[model samples]
Target: MKHILLIPENEKPTLTAAIINTLLVSVLLIALFWISLNQIQMTLDFSFIGTYRIRLIKGFGMTVALGLIGFIISFFIGLLSALGQSCKILAVRYFCNLYVMLIRGTPLIMQIYLFFYILGTAWGIENRFVAGILILSLFEGAYIAEILRAGIQALDPEQMEAARAVGFTRKQTVRFVLLPQLIVLTVPSLTGQFASIIKDSSLLSMIAVIELTQTIREITATNFKLFEGYLFLGFLYLCLTLPITLLSKRLERRFRHEA
Candidate 1:
């Protein structure tokens, strides 16, 4: 007797439901916005966008720059720290573990303040941009270290053994085999972390770093347009993060396909 096989059907996306949800969300947002504005004695005023366009543009540029620089620095730190944690040497592993623990356990804002007030002063670096970038890099490095470590460790053990059996040096094996796969695995996560870094750049504003939030504050301080200023701030953050978020998803799909 022959057996019959059944395959599960894929669920089709419903555009009608999607459209209805989008419309519902739009209506709710509009109603909430109107109510909030009324409570705050504010009306929609997009005039600030035109008036401070150049300033806002500069602020956005600065914020992007901060995130990019910090991410780059953190990437290297994370890679090295991951390598350290994976090293056979117990001292190296312990030190790396301690570093990761110290950074991950603390609040990022506290780290930023400590860097600005304590380390920056000790280093005689009065530049807020440099301080902000350094602090963020340090803060993000711990998380990225764990991400990379997990990716490296999650790789099949046979790959490493095969490389060693072929008389490949550890360094050569990591460079030629491990790193390529690790990078593919970690790309989505790294991109998402970068997006978070962009958002966290707002915290630098508390220290008077002239990023997007700071720019909004400066504009609102003079104009008293709190509602308009904050709305634009949220919009600007979405602009910065949405592209990277989408890119991460795309990269994840591509990696999965390749795998």
Candidate 2:
């Protein structure tokens, strides 16, 4: 009798099998992590969480607020910059290109320090929160501009011709024909960028912004629960970003289906 394979090489896994395998891998990874922690004789005590819950909550709120405000401001900046890149005036196009290139090329930490300390002090911007929002917006706007520019460029040239043929004014064409498709194309990336904004907001802590990371740092400084504090910080960020990631995936699928 010929030996038979339990499953064919090219066969797709069943849902039950996939679930079982995922659970098995998860358990194995957890077990390995537990073993590594034991080997290092490190213990994580989260008992202080209850005592510092109010501060943590406040810090979490601050992070969310910064991300929301930064996203809104940066989105307009990006939109205008992207449009500027296509302008008839060479100066406008060059300025937008230089802005994107400078912001994108430099490290964000360096930009944060320079903006907050040098430009911010010279401009007499005393409030850390306001300065943090501006810095974050400036950094993330470069990335958003690139995303929007790519989406704009990806459209067929024939679409513009068709719109003009239909007697649509340039503004009307942009409002009706371009914006809708651009939104659909860029939604996934924009959602993902929001997740990035939340994480990047942590860097504002360096400038004494009282966001999530800064709060965790203060707690860790007093309590000396560095690992536990940062671990919980990661958990809190996951709470924010995981949903965004899921939403991005869902939108990508919907867009693909519509296409």
What residue pairs clash in candidate 1, if any at all? none
Q: Give one digit per residue, the lDDT tens place, for model 1 in 1-259.
A: 1111222357543666556667878999999988987897776888879989999999999998999999999998998999999789999999999999999999888998888998899999899998888888888999999999989777878988999999999899989888778878899999999999999889999889999899999999999988779988999899989999999999998998654
Where in model 1 is the C-alpha error above 4 Å? Answer: 1-12, 39-41, 162-176
Stretch of 10 with least lDDT, candidate 2: 1-10
Pairs that collide, model 2: none
lDDT of 2: 0.93
Q: State the RMSD for candidate 1.
A: 5.6
Per-model RMSD to reference? 5.6, 3.1
Window of ten residues with lowest summed lDDT in model 1:
1-10
The per-model lDDT (C-alpha) reads 0.88, 0.93
Tens digit of per-residue lDDT, candidate 2, span 1-259: 1112134478776666667777978999989989998999998799999999999999999999999999999999999999999999999999999999999999899999999999999999989999999999999999999999999988878888899999999999999888788888899999999999999999999999999999999999999999899989999999999999999999988997643
